[model samples]
Target: MMKAGPSQEEIRRHNLGALLRFVHVRGPASRAILAENLGLNRSTIMALTSDLTAAGLVREELPRTPGRRAGRPSLVVRPESTRVYVLAFDVGVDRLTVARVGLGGVILDRREAARGRVAASGGASGAADPNEMVNALAAAARSLVRKAGDEATCVGAALAFPGIVRRSDDQVMFGPNLDVGGMAIGEVLSRRLGLGVPVAVCNDANLGAIAEHERGAGVGVNDLIYLHGDVGVGGGIITGGRLLGGEDGYGGEIGHMVVNPGGRRCACGSRGCLEAEVGERTLLDLAGRQESPDVPGREAVRAVVDAAARGDVVARDALHRVGTWLGRGVADLVNIFNPGMVIFGGTLRDVYLGAAAQIRSEVATGALAASRERVKLRTAALGDDTTLVGAAEFAFADVLADPVQVLARLRGAPASAPVP
Candidate 1:
């Protein structure tokens, strides 16, 4: 049986999506630039832009400085960032964040709260209880959404979670350091939010990879890896410009990779996992904080890194040891994926800044010359907000995929309300 190709309508719809996505990611573009980048003729680009502009997804304006060499300057198309937006949520081991992000990847507003047993306000049952976490997130989200102007409309929403997730159903299968497993977090939160939109849930690390590739350090690189470190480590890999999500969307659990067979036990009941060797606990213990009262996470990590910078021998040695194991895991990933870049996010960003020397030495010794030669290693360009920005990107995906139809439908729908 022969499969039919796309109809003219389908082709136009796809092109509409592609054109909108280009400008949303790359910012404003002239008609000529859009046509050139999208590989479409000027007329075709004009038609698509017209459709988008009519749908209120984009608006055209004069460029600030039209070069004299140009014959009548072409108008520049810019995303209607203020009017079109999405709600982005980040569920982490130690905190919760909700943001209103616009079409052009600009964060308009946000709310945040501390979570986990380590947080000062974390009484014990923190993110583990889905209901409690959902309540906190919903309250913050409502406050954020209430501030939106009447002209503003949310197109979609998504949650970034730090755990193994089944993206197809928004299910958290496992969380070694977190405890929100086996819960329909998105569905539960969706009802509470009353945005009349389903909240998509995905692995935090994967979103980190997507954000980094699109707007962070990995931008313009087709092959890259993003390692997110918090209470534990999770990874996102981009191979050939696409995420290497496995058959079940759990492909990037890079932290649990066994770097030492008979070493310290891990939270996932495994010994010598990369995260176990280099994660929060390892760094804290090595820095000799045996009975610290505060939670041992990013703040504690920063304290250690700061101490190392001040020439504290204990902190320096601790970072060195962890960086050695981190390098081994990074080397293995380099050998396997040969990514052009490897970015460290979350707490690892601090660790990397503190121990780049040790990690590079280990990678030099462990990774093959060809694989490691051009692979740049660095901290996340988006800083600690890497995963949170990723959530915004995820929320914007569908709208970016079909801007005209999605915006039309979203605007036509009744306004969302808080569930009383």
Candidate 2:
């Protein structure tokens, strides 16, 4: 038998979700603009906007300026930033950040804490205790939720982990920087919050790519690559304006790409991986500085950059070496993906700014002439907030996918209930 097509209700729901997603990503738009962009009639656009407004996901208001030749200014539909919020968490090797982000990508409030390594017992490994890390993150998230006031509604939550995350069940598969591999972090966080909203766990680099594509340097660029640096290197690839999550969501582990054969060993049990060749620890070691208990890794990297700015030959040389290796790795990616842009984020942003000349020189020599000319290499525009914003976006994915149903659930109403 031939398959049945979607019903009218299903089509309505899909159009509603598409309209909300467009406004959420592209900001406020007039009804005519929405109709044009979504290829829907004016009446259908009005219906969708009205439903979204009643669901507390959007609001319509008169344009700020009156049109010179119009009967009345077109109403602008905007995401309801004040009423709805998403909690975003960024888990790094040495730090944890929790943020309450509103619908329009505004960070309403945030909290941060240091993540110190768990004390080693007799012959015990010094990796961070997964339980302790979860507890600290839960506490921070709870604090932010409380600070948001009881009147505010949390639509969803997402955690950006510095590791490989299984998309099917939000299981942490591998965390070289964290000790939470195989942990059900999303389930644990949801239980800790005691909130009905489900929490999501995703790779930090993936989130970074989302944030960059939506609001940072990758904006308007369809195909791009985002490389994030923390304790280890990670990557996010965007193709055709969508994140390129491989099957099982385990793709984009660029750090493991071999850069130096038979060189230094990596934490992932690989020799001469890209991360091993150019990660923060290697940079510190090359700068003749040891990781201090008091100084954060990012701060330590900044110290090296600061020293280089002050004409320190050792610091400059260290950055150059790392940049050269980074460039070589990037060259391979360019030849393979041929992206229009390559963004360096996190600590790599500072590293790129410090050694742009060297990186560019290596790319010039290593990458194909046509590919090199088409790609733009730059630092992250969102600064330290890229992953946080990405977490928020990930949290909103469900809501954006099924706007009417998600809103009904949030409102404690039946899916078929009419907007009141």
Clashes of 1: 0
What lDDT, from 0 to 1, does candidate 1 have?
0.87
Backbone clashes, each candidate: 0, 0
Residues 166-242 of candidate 1 have per-residue lDDT tens digits of: 86787889976666647798988888877777899989999999999999999999999999998899999999999
TM-score of each candidate?
A: 0.95, 0.93
Which run of 10 residues does model 2 get worst, by summed lDDT? 118-127
- lDDT measured at residue 401 in model 1 versus the true structure, 0 to 100: 78
State in Å the error of residue 279, model 2: 0.2
C-alpha lDDT values of all predictions: 0.87, 0.87
Most TM-score-accurate candidate: 1
